[model samples]
Target chain A: MSRSRIAFVTGADRGLGLGITKRLLELGWDVFAGSYLADWPELTELSQKEPERLHVIPLDVASDESVQAASRAVEATSGRVDVLINNAGIATHYPRTIHEEQVEEELLQIYNVNAVGPMRMAQSFVPLLRAGAGKRMCFVSSEAGSINRSFRDNWYGYCMSKTALNRGVQCLFDELRPEGFTFRLYHPGWVRSYMSGELNTDGDLNADDAARMAVAYFLRNRYEDQGMQEEDRLVMRDWLGREWPW
Target chain B: MDQIVLITEAHHPWGRALVREFAQKGWRVMACSPVSVEMFQDAFDTDRIHIFTMDMRSRESVQQAVERIQEQTSRVDLLVCGTLSSQGKESAGIANMSADLVLEDYQANALGPIRVIEACLPLMDHGLRRIALLSDVQGSLGLGLSGAGTGYAMSKAALHMAYTMLHGDLGRKGFTFRLFEPGPEPETEVSAEAAAAYFTGSREDEERMVMLDWRGQEVPL
Candidate 1:
């Protein structure tokens, strides 16, 4: 097996996931970019530029079979993975209330992709993570999930799904942190990316800058999350390194 | 004419207690259960406490239940959502959790209450327009330290956000809300009586909705 660091990122076709994969590649780590959008050209082009260092594979975190296959593919190609970033997520533009619209359909669709997707990734990638030197699990969460700091009054599923993701990460931390698996529960701080089915230009930051902060946090303390004194406790930190209430 | 209150998941202890407490206070109670509600009909005054067969998981069932409620009463004064899905083995770690089990909890705990809430909104206007929700401390992102009850915690957190959004919209429309995290302790089962009292009492913060634990401590969102 190669001594070089290995990182696997889901939703790496474009936006923050792609940006993170690019940053990891630039930092000299061999990155397995899990591409859901097989047709999206940026990751493919990046892989072509750095063929030996970047391996792009088809992955869908929402499906059990797809996640399982992606994990096996990564394990076969890379032998082990140092970091697993579960960043694949989806959101809706509908701001309608339950009185105005039937919310069950949207809730199910978003929850399956945004909340359950990462748990599937974690389950599939844990074996490879255990074999590697750096056992770090990073998540691309949002301030929308922060119930304490919540401001939006209309859309439900995205925020609810993110909140679920935050709690899910906390639960994972409770179990895995004891096994020397450190976690990064990150809020990327509203970067302009492809969350609304297109590259959004409204947000203050861009994908590359958000990915820069995310990669730095993901690799901190060599393996362990910085300032975490106890193994069982976990905190959600933003791009600015400010601790957020879980 | 008495004030009318609608409570879901009357099968659960918390739901049953709320029904009893509300009925004893001379308010008309609509106790909704998926199972047979024969016991409630005899226990409380049949005129005050009525039973409806409702399954929150099914939108059809919820719509039918709300229609039945509308035919009997002109308006519903209070809506107390007691439906929850947290139970044994649903607390399994992330790796071991069954996706079906997790989604089942989401159906019950997260989306179920809203299914009923939205249907009952039309009847709430010109009434008390008060909404009450039962929450778990496990749902609090700021308080979650337990091992993964992925579905339960996620669903509860989802429900809490829904509550927040509901408050934001309806609070401006002369509606009041009470979110109570009931417990004998945070580690054990919910305390129905304390929750009943908390729900029946006055608000501490009039400007915005807040979740209060059994000890009346303000729980962070």
Candidate 2:
């Protein structure tokens, strides 16, 4: 049997990130779960469940020092990292607009965390990724970033931050394409995470369903042949594996 | 007949497929990229596809492409812009990344598309036309975690705002704007070897690449 892969997921304390971490552990992989808040109860329980397989660490993707510290901790313990999931994220308030009346300093906060955080994670952990068996980096992006399908007008700050993240992932893909790493910018659709006020759902999936689907996608490993083709980037597949146009 | 003009940024492996798909659908397809014809021969038919050699980062290149389109067609029915670039894993961190890298992201991801829109607006046939800009979930202000790609993220966020404002400002003129978010792709079929190559020297990164696919859900954009 293939050796169990090592995975590192940011924002694994709760929501989609937590679900993903749980699923990875269940699959027999060694997981380095990063959480901004070190004392998260869910993480405590997870570590207890699989003391050897799970390593919970403090990680703030937005902070350089924090990211470096987390990387050092991982390197000391694991020696190699097979997968890096940039899933640690936050969603401030809702119904945002670009006009001055609706804008605030909170907008910058959003950008710092959403836009810069993942890049920091990649930079800090890429060396470990290079030493792993599977050189893959996955960014938990959303279709909200797609320029081709935007029709609404209220989500100014949120929309803007996500758009930047998408662009960053594309750049990363290009930068890493020559180096031989499989980089993916993914939109986990709308799942019922804490940031979504537990209201985001696409009818068929909850957090667990979304996590399962994401893991399934990761296991398939078809990025090399397909690359980031337009159709692939914006594909909307149902729970039944049916594809939908963006 | 419903007149449609689909514009795609010609880079990456997907550009060719985009050109082919739109052309087959009978839409007037316009593909622009810095690469030579020989580079994308498989994806575009020189005779059937309207090809423009332009750098999205340059205003002149954008203007030239717009002029060529104007000469051939009086108005554009639909507009779609897809452009991408990268800085590689060696330059992943803030210390390793440069200001130019960030600017390049904005020029290519944000300004380029806006410039294209500015040029194409004159050709938009009033209320009948629709425009869509590609964006991602990563730019979510509420869900952000860290500083990943300063330039890329800032540009995308700017573009999203641009699109949102455009939707409102243009609504009076009968133009429709929409943001489409594409969920993550399954990782099983993606090549590990190719992914390894992209990592280059990071052959030992043990992190498993798992993508969370949204289960056919609509995001609240």
Candidate 3:
């Protein structure tokens, strides 16, 4: 039990999750990097630089066994998780529609990884989260789930799965708020990730900007004397702190 | 040839009332209920009202129903998505809300409706087509009251966005969208006020496609 704050971030190999892991490390928190792929060059190189702080582990959010093992590994090494970021998700690219016969398969596959995956992570890592001081669970959801401000159609699987993910966050908040545990659902505003087809230049907020905002909000929620009110516990907000539609 | 209206979540009180109303108005009604079809067959005229078993969470079921409806009618004048989750009141607290249960809410409130809408689109090309979504004040982020049963509110909010996204292409195709909040008072049976509030707000024009309260007032999204 070193008093150092600890964070476990999924999808740490690249994109917003990786960016958030890096930022948390820079902020002096010991981070457990959970990546699906074993050999992500960036995570490997970064761990070498801060061996004691960043520990990369294999985690498949969709797998009960994988998440359980990852939880055990984190418990053995760090003993606690102050903040758990459920950021691992997959978006089936364009051409997904209810009319397509293949969309039924796509919806199930995407739902398993995107909607059910985070819930698995949350359930598996609860012990570690409860062991720490700030028991905050952050879900990296998306605007595609926004039923109020929906601007496009055709990506039925991605949109519905994210919507389901949002509901799961609400459930987590309902279940944990009484225990003084906090939850955050962040719509990481369009970052250049593998999903959005913006792998290069900035897509609205780059991965770093999105990650910085998300981590900042998490720290503020954790350390501030003015904790969230009862009604504010399970809210979906943009990276900039503006409340988003359910 | 009578005009056709399709209603989802017909097991709901409001949805059932709407089906009866449309049936009486001489419009052929296609009602899809998550429960048994027997609940609907005895009440309404079988000649004008058709009921089918459909679950919003399952895309396959919705597709099947849509295909069945297409066999009878070439176009649908109205598509009322009245699907909503009753699970919110059951899981009042944050901790009590399980992931599986919340996912069920999403399936009922958002995913199922979207599937129905998309499947019914081809038959929805009639000019001035009205798509009414029975939404709620709880889903509005501006109200900040959605924290209670987060799943219900989140699912409604997701449904709102899904329709709005459809507006870009669908609107241009002469489809108009409306989000209606049914308020707290459940009409044990349909009333004039309930119909007025749910179908038309301050204005009756098909062009008004924003969110409206049960009283027909525009709700800030």
Candidate 4:
């Protein structure tokens, strides 16, 4: 029998990261969940359920030392990572509007966690991803970043940081497509995550459902020759697999 | 009394031309940049123009400037933002530049403008408020992987999206958001003239959410 595929997820303490981790584990993949906190009730419970298959690692996406240490720990134990999901992000900087003074420092802090965090993960985990069978790196982004369709304003920090994240993902795709690496940016659909903080989501899907769709979509489409097509190089797909404009 | 227009990054050639264009048209022009007071006086008439020391990267400085403007006048008819970092020009490939540097570029190009626009929105509630963001064609998705300066292109592209969002949200509120691509070069003489004309002309519904070249020709969104 083939060995279980290994996956690494950031911000796995709760929300979409936790959902993705649970879904991946249910699918029989050994999961390395990265979180800033060492212990969470949900994570502890999950790890207890599948002690051998699930491993929780301390990670802080905003810090270089933390990311590097996490990468080294993963390399030491797992040796290979099939799917690397850059899902760690923060939306704490709220009340973004045109009338407020430019909160440059706060915006930078958001950019560090939301945009640069993904880039850092990608760089640190590329070796493991290349060694695994599933060469996919996914970024959890949002529709607020879409320039063509974005209508809601006043999310100055989140919106711009996500846009930068999308652009960074595109650059990564362009540079790594030839090497059989597939990159995707997914808008997990508005969920009741800690990030959104109850913002007008009457019909939004829950985190688990969105996560199931993510895993299904990746499994179905990751192996196809998407690199040959120019469009796949820079697509921000919805959970249902529809492309969102960058 | 003439209407007021606030232009950020006023030290640039295009920004200077915009200042002169609005000033010549007898509009009250307030130009903000990190440059010194003597530079503003050297280039334009201090009597016709108001210059403020502002840096897009600092919240305190931007807030002070916006408050000062609010104190002077309650309305700003036209807002033109010309702030963009030179890091993209100095960097090599996207892979080589540290993520922090790229974030810096986004801060200046994308976040700075959003903050400025948000701050100036209240002052624009009375009339046909217009926002023209001076971006680049390099920001267009059509460029794809063919372009260099990945950081700049990416941030400018983010700026493009910001303007699009503003257009959608403010279109009904008498706000006209335009992405003004003045080409990659710095020859502002012709484009600035066309842009001034476009900005001064009657508000056209079709121009909302539109990306226009210096000649006022619509570019693909």
Per-residue lDDT value at A183 in model 3 = 82
lDDT by residue (tens digit), candidate 4, A154-217: 7767787787678777767777777888776888887766564343345487778878987776
Query: Compared to the true structure, candidate 4 yields what TM-score?
Result: 0.87
Model 1 reaches an interface RMSD of: 1.3
Q: Of the candidates shown, which would achieve the greatest TM-score relative to the real structure?
A: 1
Q: How much is the lDDT of residue A207 in candidate 2?
A: 75
- Which candidate comes out best when scored by lDDT? 1
- For residues A61-122, what per-residue lDDT tens digits would candidate 2 score against the true structure? 77778888999998888777889988876676566442223333455555556767787787
**Candidate 3 at B217: error in angstroms?**
5.7
Question: Which sections of candidate 1 miss by over 4 Å?
Answer: A222-233, B36-45, B184-190, B214-219
lDDT of 4: 0.77
For each candidate, the DockQ is 0.66, 0.13, 0.26, 0.42
Model 2, span B1-221: residue lDDT tens: 63545455655544455455556656666677777646765666544577777677766787788888777677777776655644232234344764446545656766566667766777886524667565555444333324455464456556665665576656557665545433333321232222212212221322211111123233433
TM-score (chain B only), all candidates: 0.90, 0.74, 0.87, 0.91
Worst 10 residues of 4 chain A by lDDT: A194-203
Cα lDDT tens digits for candidate 4, B1-221: 67889999988888888899888889888889977767766898557788888888766778789998777778899999887666445444445656666667787888778777777787888765888888776666544543455567677777877776677667767677667876545668777778888876865465456778887676754
How large is the interface RMSD of each prediction?
Answer: 1.3, 7.4, 3.9, 2.4
Ranking by lDDT: 1, 4, 3, 2
Please give, for residues B70-127, the per-residue lDDT of candidate 1 as tens digits: 8889899888887656556665687777777777778888888888888898999887
